[model samples]
Target: MGSLMHLIPVTDPADPRLAAYTSIREKDLTSGHGGRFIVEGKVTLETLLTRSRFAVESLFLAESRLAPLADLLAKVPADVPVYTAPQDIMDQVAGFPMHRGVLACGLKGDIPLPGEFISEDKPRSGPLLLLSDISNHDNTGACFRNAAAFGAGGLLLDERCCDPLYRKAIRVSSGASLFLPYAHGGTGLDMVNAVLNAGYTVWAMTPRAEAQPMQSLPVPDKLAILLGAEGPGLPDALIAAAEPVRIPMSAGFDSINVATAGAIALAHVFGEKQG
Candidate 1:
C-alpha cells in the first residue's frame, strides 16, 4: 500500500524547512541535542517506519528516486512532509554526495536507564549484550545489528559508549539500531549488576589464559554477554567479576575484531540453546 503523504517539492537547498537535513555530519543529532537524527538508505528507512517508537519527522529523497519508494512512502502518515529534490540539490544540502538518494530525519525519544531497559518478565531466557566503552560508532552499530540478528533481548551501554543513533552508525547498522531496544546508562559495573539482578548469567569475553575456552563454556538459560572496546578488552576487575571466556584460536593469534567476536559469541550462545 502506498502512503498519501504531503509531497513537498524542494527547489532550494537552503530552505529553512530543510534545517534538519542540513549539514547532518557536522551537527549533533544523537545526544537528542536537536531531538532528531538522520537515517539514510532504503533499508534503514524501512526499518524505522515499521518500529513504532521512532517517529518520522520528515523525509527527503531525490526526485528520480521517489517512484521506486512509492509503496514504502505510502505507509508514511499524511501529516509528515515528504520532500523531494533534485539529486544535485540534495548533495548541496547534505554537503556530500547523497548517492542513496533517500534520507530521513527521525525524532529520538528519552533514553531509559539500564535497570529500566531489562525486563523482569522472562528475564532469564534470551541473550543480552552488555557493551562497555565501545566508543567506535561502526563497532557499536555492528553489535546492534548482531544483537538483532541473533535475537538478543536488548543492549545496555556504559557511559563511555558512543551513541548508536549517530548517522554513520545507523547507516552501518543497516537500520538495526533504530529497531533494536537499547539504553545508555551507568558505569560498566553498574550495567553488569542490573543484568545480574534481572536473572542473567554474565559472561565477559577476554583473551586471558585463565578464561574458559568458548567450546567448553555452557550456554546458560539467560545469558548476558559482556564486550568492551577493541584494544583494551574488558577491565581486569570486570573480567574477574564475571565468568571470563575466550574464543579459541591459534596460539599466535588470540584476538579478533570486537564486532566479529560479538557475532561469534552470540552465535554460540544462541546455537547452543537451540541445539
Candidate 2:
C-alpha cells in the first residue's frame, strides 16, 4: 500500500502545483468548508495520515528529509501521490522557516455528529465537556487536554470554535487532540440539550456572582462543563440553559483561565485525585 512518488523538484515558490496547500496559512484554514488542511513535518503529517479520518490528497517533502520518513510514506496507499520539492522551495512555499522539511495537503477532518461523538457507545460514567465560542486554539487545546486527562467522554464545541486540528492547538495538545473524539455545530443550546437528553447534567462555567461554587456542588453521575471564551465568558443563552458553576476564587482574584478551570472542574467531576 505504499504511495507512489512523483518526485518533482519544485523550484519556483509560485508554482501552480503548490496551490493545493499554499493558502493553508493559519487564518485561512481556521474555519471553512472546502478549505484544505496541511500537516507539516514528517511526524505530524504521517500521524495525521494514519490516525485522522480525513482524505490524504498529497504529501510533499524535501529530498533530504525523505529517507527518515520513508517508512511512513510506505504506509500510504500507492494511489496517493507523494511529491518532492527542494528544501528551499518548500520553505518559500510554506512562508515559514522550515525545520521538519516536509508538509502535506489533505481534506480537513469534518466534525462528527454530536450524538456519535458522545453516544452511549462512548465510555462514560459521567457528563461531557461542551466548549462554546472559545476559539483560541490554545484554550481549546488545553480544554481537550483537561477533558481527556479527567476522563470526560468527549469534547464538544460550537460551529464557531477554532479548528481543533489547527497547528497551535495540535502542538499545544502534543497530538492528544487527535486521540479523543470531538464534535461541532448547532447553537450552544442545542449542545446542552443533546447532553441533557443523554442523561448528563450540564454545568456551564462562569464567574457570575449568582453562579454556584464549583467546590460546593454535588456533581451528577454524568456532567458536561460548558466553557466560554477567555474574557467574555459564556453567552447568556447557554447560561440560562445550563447550570452555572464557578470555580471559587479569593475575593481579590477574579477568574481563572478557561483551560485551568476546565482541569479543576474535570477533576472534581470525575472525582480524580488532585495534585
Candidate 3:
C-alpha cells in the first residue's frame, strides 16, 4: 500500500525509461552507466531499499515478482520508479534469462579517499580489510561479505581490484557491497601508507616463510589486514613495509584463496576482540 507501489508497466525492452537496464551484462563489464550500478535479486533489492547508503535510482521487476515483493516495494521512496515487465521483456533487457526477476539501479555517490574512509574521527569497531590486485569479482564480493560479518570498519581496494559494485559481485556479496563503506582506487602500497599514516597498524598477509603467524600477534586498537591476489600474493615491498603475518597451513600447502584467507584473518582479529 506504499505510495510508490504504483507500478509503471514496461512492455518494451527498448523503452527509453528503462535505458539503464538494457544490455546489463554488457554494461556491467564495460563502463559506468552514468554513475549508476545494477543491483539484482530480492535480497539485494531489499538491501538497496532498506539499508544501502546508495540512492535507489529505480527498480525493474517481472510481473510475477510484484506480489512476493509487495511489502519490500512499499518501502521504496516516492520519487523512485517501480517498473514491471513480463519475464520475456525482463530477460531481453538484461541480455539473459531473468531468473531473479528483480533488479534495481543504484547511484554511486561520493567515494571517499582511503584516508578519509578510515579517518580517526569515524567511529569503527573492528579491523579494516585492505585488498590488492584482487581482480576476481567472486573473491571481491566474498571479502565484502566477510568484512561485514566480522564487524570490520570498512574496506579499501587497490586500483587493480575488480569493481565490487559489479552486478554479479553485488549479488555474490549478498548486498554487503551496498552498505559496507569502501574506497576502491590507488596502488596497494598507497592504501597501506594511507592507513599507516592514519595510525592503523598494518598487517600485510603473505605466505612467506619469514612472516609471523597471525594468531600470535595481538590485535591493535586500529588494524588493517592487507590481502593480495591469490597466486602472486602481496608485493614484497608492501610486505616489508608492514608487519607480515600468515595463517599457518599444513606442509606443501602454502596458501588458500585470497577471500578465504581474508576471512580467516578477520576471524582471528574478531576472536581477539571478543576475548
Candidate 4:
C-alpha cells in the first residue's frame, strides 16, 4: 500500500496549484490543454497509474473517495502530488458536479509516428483498427473499447478524428484509450498506406453493393480494418485503395453505427484467429 502523506488538502477552489482543472467543460470544447488531459473516476485513474504509458501530473480526489481508492492510490509515483478536497470544493474547481470524486491530469508524452507505430520490427498478434473522421467522442471511445476487447494490435486515426484522450472519450472508452497504442494525424489514405507498406492486408469496410461479404474471406496474418464516420462513411478513394468488405445486412438498412460495425468485424476476425 502507498503512503497517504503526499495528500494535500485544498480548501480553496481558485488555488493556483489546481489551475489545470478549472473550467473543464469549456476547456474540453477547445483543443490542446498544453499537452495535458484530465481523466475522471477511480477506474480510469487506476488504469492511468497501472496500464497507461502517460505520466500522471497530479490527482484530485474528494475527501470521501480517499478511503475507497486506497489501494489504487498507492500506485501513484512518490513525486506526484495528490490533492484532496470536499465534494463542494471539488465541484467548484471542476465547474460542475464531480460525481465520480476522482480526477487526474496526465501528460501526453511523445506519440509515435504512423510509420514507427506500424513498423515491421514490432511484433503484434492481432489486427489494427484504422479510423477516419470520427468526430464523436462517444463513438471514438467505443471504437477503442472494441479494439482493446477484441485484441487489436493498435489503432490509427485520421487527422479529422477527435482526440482519443479527450475527457469524455476516455470515460466512454472506459479507459481503453489510455493503454491502447494509437497514432492520430494525416489523412485516411495516409493511415491505410502506412499499414499496407508495413506488409499488412487492408480491409476497407463499406456497404456498397460491389463490396465482398466479410465472411467470404479468411482472416490474414496481418490485417487492418478501416472504419469511417457515421453519415459520410469512408471516402471513395480510400475504399477503392483496399479490399472492400461489407457486413451482410438487411435490404433497406445499408449501414450500422461505426463502433458497432467495428466490433462485429473485429469479433469475426478474432473468432477466426482463435479457431
RMSD to the true structure for each prediction, in A, is 1.7, 3.1, 1.5, 1.4
TM-score against native, each model: 0.95, 0.84, 0.96, 0.97
What TM-score would you give candidate 3 relative to the actual structure? 0.96
lDDT of model number 4:
0.91
* Per-residue lDDT of candidate 4, residues 90-186 (tens digit): 9999999999999999998767666668874768879999999999999999999999999999999988999999999999999999999998888
Backbone clashes in model 2, listed as residue pairs: 126-222, 127-222, 127-223, 128-223
Q: What is the lDDT of residue 116 in candidate 4?
A: 66
lDDT tens digits, residues 74-161, model 1?
7887778889999999999998999999999898878777887875353434688999999998999899889888888888998999
**Candidate 2: tens digits of C-alpha lDDT, residues 1-275:** 24535556677889887776564553556356675666666556766767766677777788787778777777876666777777777777777766777777667656675665666474654457788888787888788778867887778887768877776676576555666677877777777778878777788888899999888887676778888888888889889988888888898887889899888888886774332
Is candidate 1 or 4 superior in lDDT? 4
Give me candidate 4's TM-score against the actual structure.
Answer: 0.97
Write down the lDDT that model 3 would get: 0.88
What are the runs in model 2 whose C-alpha is more than 4 Å off?
4-8, 30-33, 113-127, 271-275
TM-score, model 2 to reference: 0.84
When sorted by TM-score, best at the front, the candidate numbers are 4, 3, 1, 2
